[model samples]
Target: MPTPSLPHKPITVSIVSHGQLSLIQPLLGQLDRWCTDSIEKVVLTINIPETDLLGGMRWSFPVERIENPAPKGFGANHNAAFTRCATPWFLVLNPDIRLDGDVLAPLILQAGADSGLLTPRILEPGKSAPEAHRALITPVEILTRNRPGYAAPSVPSWIPGLFMLFRSATYAQIHGFDERFFMYGEDFDICARTQLAGWKLEVAEKLLARHEAQRASHASRRHLYWHVTSLLKVWTSRAFWRYVLQHGGR
Candidate 1:
């Protein structure tokens, strides 16, 4: 738990885990090897309904686990943990992600300049880089592109929430992700809010991370219901409606 040797201000890396105990070690190992000197603290938010096993786990970096009720959605859990972050930069990582050595440093620098929110290029597990980050979300983008037959449309501002690095001040100013969004669309909502608040959202193409996309919640019907409901809520928001009306939804 030694302090990270950072060049500028220390950044706090916050990871949100539901029940991916198997992936936690490897993920932390990669972070320690890759981000050793860059990250100051690694805060793990564990959704523990009763017992707290995270406290007993071994991690290579300075780590702390905060136990809380199983959250309604991803955004809610992250919002809960956001209050405890005191760093200039905060990294929101999923448990199933492994970072490349140079991934976060450049993103942190970009965010420091003008980007309020920055997400790294995400690669599917065991694969090379793929085009995962994109522009803002629209109903048509969600319906048409996300389906099997349709192709994803071009966007100017969308980025995956799997590995988001944001300015702590900007995150606090925007009040973090909307808690109403249980899971899906929360990142989109936050991006939209960032634009509305006059903050820049950037995709750091050079930074890369491998994502397994595996999660306990993603396998359940209850989780699907919450995801759909939250997505609809974000799509139907006033800002999104205006974008839809003006741009034809995609």
Candidate 2:
């Protein structure tokens, strides 16, 4: 029998959880099957120390759970997650995202220097901001995603962090997500930085994934504050305009 082919390097998968015990349980369950022999390592960061629900789950791959008693910002947590990763490719996944099939293998094979950032067609339940994938982060977009049906732009520039596959080198060139963004805007900031550094973002229209966003901001006043604050943080920053001018965005 011919020798089986092995991956050049294993892909690292990570998810930061903040009290999404219920939602993540199923997500991980689906991931258990999907990851199988393909994944090298899986790290699940428990932001809520009290909730170690993921600790009990039976993971298929070499999964590790980190306990963060005093959880930091979203980017900081992921950046922390990245420290333990030694893979050529890394996937920053959201806790609310569910996998229907294999999204990593295909995306990795298609991604390279020309397109280091690969995003899948994020199918959100209902009219839940599918337009987020094909957009440039702007004040209007920030408002529209939360409100829905407000005419999002057709141009594609950024991808949602719900499922972003990054080449390790490209991610390092952009220096990963900005630690400043606590809960939001990190996704937009990273994409902008990637574009500024001359890496193209590609969307896999056929490679589909599902997003089950709770819209916690809309439900809770605190998250709403963070959402609005992060929007302002991304747009008002000097880097935002620098990227705009360099990348030809208004």
**lDDT of all predictions:** 0.71, 0.77
Tens-digit per-residue lDDT, 38-133, candidate 1: 777788877755344445665555787677754546787777777777778888888888766767776665554557887777788666657544
Best-fitting candidate, measured by TM-score?
A: 2
Off by over 4 Å in 1: 1-9, 49-60, 70-72, 126-128, 146-155, 215-219, 242-250
Global CA lDDT computed for model 1: 0.71
Kindly provide the TM-score of model 2 when superposed on the true structure, using C-alpha atoms: 0.88
Steric collisions counted per model: 5, 0
Which sections of candidate 2 miss by over 4 Å?
1-9, 127-132, 142-155
lDDT of 2 by residue, 1-250 (tens): 8844437546888888788777878877887777565577778788875555655557777677787879788888888888888988788989899888877777766665588788888887886435454466776665676674665555566776788888778888888999878887888888888878888888876788888877888899888888889988998887788877876773
Q: Could you tell me which 10 consecutive residues in candidate 1 have the lowest summed lDDT?
A: 48-57
